[model samples]
Target: MGVAKKSIEEIVQAIGGKENINKASHCVTRLRFSLKDESVVDTETLEEVDLVKGSFSANGQYQVIIGQGTVDKAYKVLLEVTGLQESSKAEVKDEANEKLNPFQKLVKLLGDIFIPILPAIVTAGLLLGLNNILIGEGVFYDGKSVIDVHTQWKGFSEIVNLIANTAFTFLPGLIGWSAVKRFGGSPLLGIVLGLMLIHPNLMNANEALQQDVLPQWDLFGLGVNQIGYQGQVLPVLFAAWLLAFLEKWLRKIVPDSIQLLVVAPVALLVTGFAAFIFIGPVMLTVGTAVTDGVMAIFGNLGGAAGFIYAGINSLLVVTGMHHPFIALDLQLIAAVGMTYLWPVRVMSNIAQGSAALAMMFVTKKKTLKGTALTSSISAFLGVTEPAMFGINIRFKFPFVFAMIGAAFAGMIVAMNNVEGTIGIGGLPAFLNISPNFWSVYFLATVMAIVIPFILTLVYAKVKHKDL
Candidate 1:
């Protein structure tokens, strides 16, 4: 028999529905629920519903993984059935209650693990990318200037660079903390391991190896390379997780009398060496492979590639898969000195932003109108989360039209050979275009904005009646 199509009311009842749900939200792939209490709902029963992908309780909230398009549908049903609205109140609840939803739990966990460290990353990336641009443009002599690095006017640049460089410098530490949290270990120990990797002596040794100078350094007959381990990913994170797992097992075997000293030393030594020899290389290789594949595909496609790339890229951003691709693109730009992805990315962001703006003008609901307004502004600032999650995903057809509009603009830009030299993409990426092609770049940027804006307005006008 076909699975029963549970009405919103029945599904709500199964999941401990109330006259009004206190808060509701979603993650990349889950419809998260924070109800008054867990005892009222039958989570297992809710999972049996046809529309529900899967349901589970984690942290403190009930999470229903509803896939991509389904999350918006489920969110709509939730809002309609429960007569509840999303707002700031939903985000300020007790940690215990917040954890009930797996999406919320993951967000909280990732936040706790990464938020303290993100400033450094953002700063480093901005500085490094900007530095490359300045140096390329001959704005600074030999990529260093008293004014560029130390002056008061350069405070913004210095702060950003410091953050980026520091983050990269202590990357292992960041990974260690995240890995420890992921593996349920003592996060501090992971950070300690990260610090150990970036020690000065180790960095000096790595420099020697790069010069093919064999240094007289051996521990247990294994040659040690002094490599600077800042700004690196993969290895430290893998090592931290590996150490956490080993520590968990060792704790069971070692007697309490000497467990602390013996188990910790063994776990750290084994994991640290493993990271240097195996995990780091493996991660680097994977990142390289993914980047190479994307580049190869993009290179082979030529002028027409932008259409498919822009359309799919917009969809990925809306679905939260854009980050991985963006990460790879940035790495490629850093390594190869050019990028093809930014033209498409910039167009897509503006397209979505324009769509949100259009939605603001047409939507009668004050709540949605406000959300659209905020989201559109956020997108202009290169923060698309508000636009994608708050407006585009909910309004549906507007996003589709936006993608179509972006693809059209992107194709024209690509055909004109519009490219960005900088690592950062989005609206700001226009500044990174080569001056020789400024005329073409300006046209591309205008097209990116206008095409999407016009299409979005037309789509919203036509679709408004249906909605």
Candidate 2:
């Protein structure tokens, strides 16, 4: 307790004391602080502190890296000693955004809105992967799926398919709920708007394309397509923003006595009409175009696209710009059956893991060896921040070697056109790969792992003998 307290106190002082801290929060493995003055931070001293694994500023927050189990303890002690109430992640993010430029703030806003919805999306992805395994022909048995081999379990496979598809089927609701809350409006209203978009009365989005004439609402001799926004992301996001803006604006002008009765209906009615007429059609086209354009570029570039994306992905992770890609991956999956980006992302992750693993074998320092070993394992499990920020990036050359390995693996992924579901990555990522591409993806993954390990270990030993 005494040791922990001292470490927490030093961390506070090193970041220019408790007075400099505007808001503070913790996420998985780091203490994120929005400070009054970043220039006052003594990063070197903070990194030297016993409990702090490392420290860096990114996403408008000064993040002090600490191991998972220890970060909670440190955060608790920090709040107690500083006499600052523990801030919610959102609150801290808002405070952090005060320091960012307009572009950075916009990116951070998207990250904030989408992150809360990832759990549902990720769970859906895993379940989808499971469904793929069970129903995918030639995956388990030769030319037959588990259900095909055992007709008795056909009902079971059907149920799994139903459950796995729920999130994507009603993605607008998920995005609307999160985006509205992030924009500072009533979440329930956002949900209502989302539900209205995909109401059972409206024609299903997927089925509408097949019909010669879409179901339409005759509004004073004008025809409007009564189509649902199922699986659509951008339209939902825009609708949510408009809903929040309308709700806030209504609340301000409407008399408080009648506000409760008047505001909800007025806001919903206006937004619903606007969404059906303007936002939904326009943003859906925009979203489809964006996804199609991205795929076309990747298809045109083929291996070069993979090489470029994988090579620079680690740098994106470093700057904390990678969060928005989660939304993009999700978008691509919704537009198309699968995303090619995810396979390359997995390759990049394991390459960094392999590089860190290499350091464990070559480094003389016990602390460095331990960090490399554990972080490498973590990276293989799909979380690469520790390995990238803690081990590979810190050493410089290891990161370069990791990128080189990633580029090679990415080329293989692109040439073969490997594709997978979103949100699943690293070694267990094979489960998410399209069943047909499993063998080739595995081969590419092996190269991702081996090439980096060999390169980092060999280069470090030959060039930097001081270690």
Candidate 3:
């Protein structure tokens, strides 16, 4: 642990030392610091630290991406070196909140609400990808899917399909529970609100869209539509926020003696009515418009859209703004059959991975080469933070070369109209791609990898000899 300890000390020194660190915490993959002075931090030196995958300032904190299974270790060492005790994530977030702008706060809130639910979504995605293989044409048999060729697997395929779709079908429930928790409300009450939105008594959101008229209840001489929000985003998010706001305010005013008895029912009843009458319809309309607008823009731009998204994806990752796109992917999948953006994102991950790997060969420094090898492999496995922040972005040229490769690959993705379900990125992510387009997608993935690796190596050799 001596070498590891030294590296941790380096991280502390680079971040303007213990004096600058007001508080520190770690999430799944990053060491988040509430710093007294962020400008004093040495970004280049911080990036060069052995265990640091990348570093950036966002959401009112300086975050160092250290990769999973390793960040915890680093965080522990960080605490030891800084002579600071561990702080809860919420505590650290509170420490940093005053530094955030409204927009940054909103992005941070969305990230907090969504990040917890990713494991469930990723599991469903992997299962969905498997189900796609079972039903997809041209994958296992000549001109036919495995289930089509063999009748015995039909029931199994259906079971897989059912399980794979559960998260999406009940997405509002998941979001409601998470969003309410983030908003400082009772999570169980949020779950109840979510269930109320998708109750069997109401018309399913998808089926309701197909009908010209929706069933309604006459309340105070006004018709309130009895429609369910099954796989929606914006509506539930707004509803959850409203529920939390009401619950918290009710607690403050109500006498503590009877607060428990009065709060839950009153909050739920009022929020329920408000959701069905005002919040649901309005936000659903907004969500639909946003999804349609995005699809229309991408559809019109075609290859150009892919080029731009892929080219700038790494930059967005740095700013932590990419978190919203996960919600957008879910919205797109609900509105349309698939999300086109995910495939391009996967290509970007691959390009970052390959570009980092090129440094393993071009650079003579053993520490950098070691970092490049491990981080490259990490990037290829669907996490690019280390590759992007640690190596490529640190060096400058590799980052640009990676983006160039990603742009070309993303163009191919758009030109072919490739689409994929939400899943992990990098090599394993190809499973999420539409099986019909597997051959072409494979070609694009190759270009995403090969172009960056070769270009980075050649550029270093010819242009930057000392690199």
Give the number of the best model, judged by TM-score.
Answer: 3
Residue ranges of candidate 1 with Cα displaced over 4 Å: 1-31, 34-117, 126-163, 203-230, 291-309, 317-319, 326-346, 364-368, 408-445, 462-467
State each model's CA lDDT, in order: 0.63, 0.86, 0.89
How do the candidates rank by TM-score, highest first?
3, 2, 1
What does candidate 1's lDDT look like per residue over 1-467, in tens digits? 22233555666788776542556777766677666676777755765565554455545656665556666676766676677776332362453444345655544544455545555554555566564444343334554554555456466655655654565556667768766866777788888888876776664322432466644447688775445454454456567779999899899999999997988899888887787666755765665576577676667664578888777776664433454443444445533545677766677777778788887888786766776787787676666656665567655776777787778767766666665543344566555555445466567667666766677777777767543
Candidate 3, superposed: residue stretches over 4 Å from native: 3-10, 27-30, 47-54, 65-81
| Predicted candidate 2 versus true structure: per-residue lDDT over 27-137, tens digit per residue | 989999999999999877876777766777887898888888778888888989999998998798777877899888877788888888888887888888888888889
> Using Cα atoms with residue i matched to residue i, what is each candidate's TM-score against the true structure?
0.64, 0.93, 0.95
Clashes of each: 14, 0, 0
| TM-score (C-alpha) between model 3 and the true structure | 0.95
lDDT of 3 at 58: 75
Which parts of model 2 have CA positions greater than 4 angstroms off? 1-6, 9-20, 39-45, 76-88, 206-212
How would you encode candidate 3's per-residue C-alpha lDDT over 1-467 as one tens digit per residue?
Answer: 32388998899999998999989999898899999989999998888776777787877888898877788888888888889989987788899999988888888888999999998888888889999899998897888999988989999999998998999888888999999999999999888888889888999876887889899999999999999988888888999999999999999999999998999999999999999999988988898898888888788897999999988888877787888998999899877758999998888899999999999999888878888999999999998988987889888899999999999999899878898889888999988888998988999999999999999999998987776
User: Any idea what lDDT model 1 has?
Assistant: 0.63
Candidate 3 or 2, higher lDDT = 3
